[model samples]
Target: MPQKGSRLTPEQVGLIRAWIDQGLQWEEGATFAKAPVLNLSPRRPELPGDEGGHSVDRILASYFARYGVKTSRVGFWIDFLLDACISTRLACCRQ
Candidate 1:
């Protein structure tokens, strides 16, 4: 059975339905079918940078470059950490 939260294309759904209709009998040693790979690459957004650009851009670019969806608060936390580190370096340079 496909795990929850897994995305299935129409074709995949049809195949599963057909399998079930065919009695869904196990061949005794049948292995679980591998799921079709989904290309969830992030799509580029219309705008390069917006209010969520800094945070989102990094996330989408990191994992799925084709889809330009931004990351959650965790991404923002990482950004904050980086920014603080850089600022600390600059402060030390000035002293």
Candidate 2:
């Protein structure tokens, strides 16, 4: 028993129908239950270098080592950075 005024709009119905029409391929165990918690309180960390840091890599290395993050992610991170830069360039070109 659907109510006349309380029913979904045609656009909303269409979106839902389209989603159902496509195979609902949701990732398995993709819950954000235990995502890494970052502490961004802005404090100088004890880095392995001359008193003050030189480049961002030095700072990032300390954080990565502290968090047990591996250097393998560098390739993925570089690719992601390149993709974002390309997207930004394309957007600027469109404007």
| Predictions in order: lDDT | 0.72, 0.72
* Cα distance off (Å), candidate 2, residue 44: 14
Q: Given candidate 2, what's the lDDT at residue 62?
A: 69
Model 1, range 24-75, lDDT digits (tens) per residue?
A: 9777868888977999999975644345546555445645545664545456
* Angstrom error at residue 75, model 1: 0.4
**Model 1 ranges with Cα > 4 A deviation:** 1-72
**lDDT assessment of candidate 1:** 0.72
Residue 60 of model 2 has an lDDT of: 73
Which residue ranges in model 2 land beyond 4 Å of their true spot? 1-54, 72-83, 91-95
lDDT of 2 by residue, 1-95 (tens): 46656888899989888888896555897775888879878987666667443445555776888898876444456678889999999999999
